[model samples]
Target: MVHNFNSGPSVLPKEVFEEASRAVLDFNGTGLSILEIGHRTSLFQAVIDEAIQTTRELMKLDSDHEVLFLHGGASTQFFQIPMNLLAEGSTAAYLDCGTWGKKAIKEAKLYGNVEVVASSKDRNYTYIPKGYNIPSNATYFHYTTNNTIEGTQMHSIPETSVPLVADMSSDILSYEMDFNRFALIYAGAQKNMGAAGVNLVVVKKDILGKAGRPLPTMMDYREHIANGSLLNTPPVFAIYVAMLTLRWLKQQGGVSVIEKINDRKAQLLYDTLDSLPVFHPTVAKEDRSKMNVVWVMDDPDLEKEFLAICKDNGMVGIKGHRSVGGFRASLYNALPLESVELLTSLMKEFALKKLNRICLRLFLSRHCGLLLSLPAR
Candidate 1:
């Protein structure tokens, strides 16, 4: 009965968890655990191969792209992408949408020149920056499709003739997207894919080895691609969980069908938040995120009380990030609409209770003639 809304290491489909549990004990009746089996075995090789194909199928990517399950998170790609693509004199363009975008830009600066096309930092990244100019000769334009920490998302990615790379760690497969538009797409599997152990790299086959640096075998994307994502022992259990998630996604009608559900879930929460008088949404109205809904109450104490009430009502992960200090309900792809409706109801109840308490205290203090009022705090 738990409603999972945590940002990362988020909720998964019930079916995925069930299927994964069975595989761990006896994989394909091999009598050996999926955990103990050698990565070079045909069984494990099928795992990596099918997982990549499922990912491509879900994204509707063509043969122009190569998918690999690398070990490092998307953060590694932030620096590695620039190092591999940008030569000594080359520049890269970045849109400063949120924390991750900013990090990618900073990492790129160490390698070569970087152009910040646009930034939402002036507004605390509450809105997406648009209509920025990309450098004519930049190696690539890097942007984060969804900002996990800030509860913001760029629904329409920026357009660029240069190679485009997206940090889709928090939004990969959450909705239907033109995967072919980007030269590279990377995601850490924690948020929407499966878990935190694996990172997905969907690269354009023609874009690698452009850098003249002496790159090691492991650092090079081509090496991992050639090895089929098992240059060494891969993350055994995480890949299988991702495979299960991909399978579950297919059963639920793939990305296009799931995109509609995601949009509906976001709308349900957003509509409720907009109507409530006590809670205020921080992100700009036009830039509302479909993946994560961030809101805060009029009073900090009230926010705390509301979170406690949500937990009491079997709603978990409703607490806000400590840095932002409000509330963030991440409605990832797998989150059911019932969870959104339940949260909206709780929000209404919390607002009503606060107002009732205030009115009752006011009436009591007013009616007592010359009586000192005691603060509830």
Candidate 2:
């Protein structure tokens, strides 16, 4: 069986896929495909409603928050958030942890002053910045909870009084945390939530309409919330699939149960990496991501050969990003522990093979030298 380790558009539960495939053909005995269902009809409405409600329940959000399924992925929120929250004169505090956070900082600058509270760019973002002070007067303190490309994660929320905003695209629902602590949380559905084409935004109701700037109807969070995330034709099929995944998450006993499984999977892989001398982990131990574990070969020349072995063994998307040439194994919520176990086993086998080859070469070299010294025998 193929093992999927892709970072985005990543693995989902097998049951979710089965249910989604059936809906594409015939939905709920309605004799109509989910793809063709009218978004405003009761049928699609129930799908969106459950999707939102499940999200709220999983996160244990209160009535003060609103969940929205929007059109653009998390990337769009980089700019849209500032448009709705950052005003002409106010400043927003940002923590630049990695690529996504940098992009967010760039976008926030367009709307208002952006004060970078801390950044780990000096070291290629291999670690999360700590002990930085958030500006008290800033409109909101924005941070990316998990850095997918860099394989770094913030294990705990920063203590701050300013409103908190987080881009949890890669790690949402993978662990349990105080979901209500953030004034706003956004995630692209493809990573841990569901298929592509839908973005999940959870915002506190009070945070809206305070930016003091007139936003275009489509750019306004209030408008989307007001319309129940149906300001326009929603991504019908994507939302349906997301609903299925969320339901699956609930049936599996919510985030608390899944978090433990995710932890075990991550720990097993990390332990393997730590024990192998040939492999080198990229991120700091404290900052290593539970979702994305990145590492490179100590001898870079062996990377291609290792990747080849992984491919031959049915591993997919084990290659890292182009910016960082290495391996990145994405352990998403739906990824079973068996996949990680297989990967770790492969890694151990590869290391042993290399060591055996080295020993054979040394043995041959020593014996050949002795034979040459014997000369005319």
Candidate 3:
């Protein structure tokens, strides 16, 4: 009954958990634990194959795109991407939407010239910036589709003929979109996809080997893709768990169906927040994220009390990030609507209780004053 709202390493399906647990003890009736399986063995190969295939199917990717499960998380791609695509003299355009985007811009600068096309930092990244022109000669235009920390999302793809690159770590596969438009897309599996220790990268085949810079074999996306993401010992257990999660996604009728459910969950929670005066959503209405919903209490002092109530009621990881202190509720694909419902109900109850206490205080102050004036009682 514990409701997990963690932004990363977030909730996953119950059935996926059960299957993964079983695999840990006995993988597909093989006596060896999934952890003990050889990475080069046919068994492990099949797992990776299915994982990649499921990802392709879910995203409706074509043969031109190559899927890879690499060693480092998405943060590694912040530099690896530039190493593989942004040549020494070339410039890459970036959209600074939030923390991750800013980090990406910093990393890209190390490889080549980086032009910040637009940024929402002026307003603390509460909304996505618009109408910025991408440089015509830029190698690629990069952006983070969803800002988990800021709780804002870019609803539409930027109109750019320059190759599109995106860090979709927080929102990948959470909703349906034109997956093929991006030349490269990378996501840390911890958020909506699966466990930690693995990062998913999907790159169009034609985009590789164009940077004209020497890259370490490990840092080269082409090397990883060429070997089918087996350039080295892969994260066997994490990949297996991610495979199970992808299967679970397929069983739930694919992204299109789940996107609707995600929408409904977000709408219900947003409605509850809007109806309550005590709670205030931080991001712009149009830019509010469907995955991570960030908000604050009108009275900052009430935050701790509300968080305490949530913890007492079995809600975990409801506190927001340290940098942006308030509250963040991540509604991942695996999180049930019932959890959101319970949270909204608790918010309403808390707000009503606060109102009742205020009314009682006001009444007591007036009555006490009247009595004191009338008599020395």
Candidate 4:
């Protein structure tokens, strides 16, 4: 069996895949394929409603928080968030964890006074930046929950009366979160949810209509929420697939249970990496990510060789990001521990051989030294 560990558009539950496979051909009570169904049809409306309801249920959100599924990607929200929330004079305090956080900070700067409260760039983003003072009057504190490229994560949120907004594109639904504390939480539905066409935006109702700016119809969170996220045609298939994934998550004892399993998987991989003398984990221990584990061998060349061996052994998507080159094994919710076990076994074997070779070379060097230094008797 094969395991897919790609960071984005990553592994999905097999049960979700099986159900989605059938829905592609024939949807509920309708002969038309799910892809062919009219977005306005009652059948599709039910699908949309169930998805929104399930999302609310999963997050345990209140009436204050309304979930909206939109067509623009999460990157779109990089701008829309500031446009819809912050005004010309207001500032948003941002924490730069990695690539996505930097992008969010960059985009928000175009709309308002963006204060970079803290950043991990000085340290190569190996650890999450914490303890920076957020301006009490700041519009909100924006952060990315997990850094897929750098393999760093914010394990717990900073306490703030000021609103907290997160770009959870890579970590959403993989674990539990305090929905009440967030003013906004948005994720692109490709990684843990479904396909790439749709972005899920969940916003607290109290946070809207405060920006007081004229937002474009497509860019307005209020507009989408007002129209039930159906102002225009939506990515019907993507939402449907996401709904199936959510259903599967529910069946597997919900996020609380899945989190336990995810913790176990991450521990297994990290422990194996630490135990192998040749492998060095890149992410800092305190800020290590559960989703992405980045590491390298004593020799960069050997790391490349190890990746090639993994690919030949039926593993895919283990290569690290180009900017942070080495090895990154993404253990999204669907990646089984068996795949991790296989990778660990290979690492152990390779490390043993390396140690043996070192031992043999040292023995020869000492023997040569004795022969050269010995006096004629």
- Cα lDDT computed for each candidate against the true fold: 0.86, 0.93, 0.92, 0.87
Name the runs in model 2 displaced over 4 angstroms. Answer: 366-377
Q: Candidate 3 residues 273-365, lDDT tens each?
A: 999888999998999999999999766679988999999999998999987889999998989999999999999999898888766666767
lDDT head-to-head 1 vs 3, winner: 3
Q: Write the per-residue lDDT of candidate 4 for residues 60-126, one digit (tens) a residue.
A: 9988999999988899999999999998999999998899989898899998999999889998899
Candidate 2 residue-pair clash tally: 0
Q: Which parts of model 4 are misplaced by more than 4 Å?
A: 367-377
Better of 1 and 2 by TM-score: 2
Q: List the residue pairs that clash in candidate 2.
A: none
Which candidate achieves the best lDDT against the true structure?
2
lDDT of 2 at 42: 98
By TM-score, is 1 or 3 better? 3
Model 3 clash count equals: 0
Order of quality (TM-score)? 2, 3, 4, 1
Better of 1 and 2 by lDDT: 2
Considering lDDT, which of the candidate structures 2 and 4 is the better prediction for this target?
A: 2
Query: Better model by lDDT, 3 or 4?
Result: 3
Q: Name the better of 1 and 4 by lDDT.
A: 4
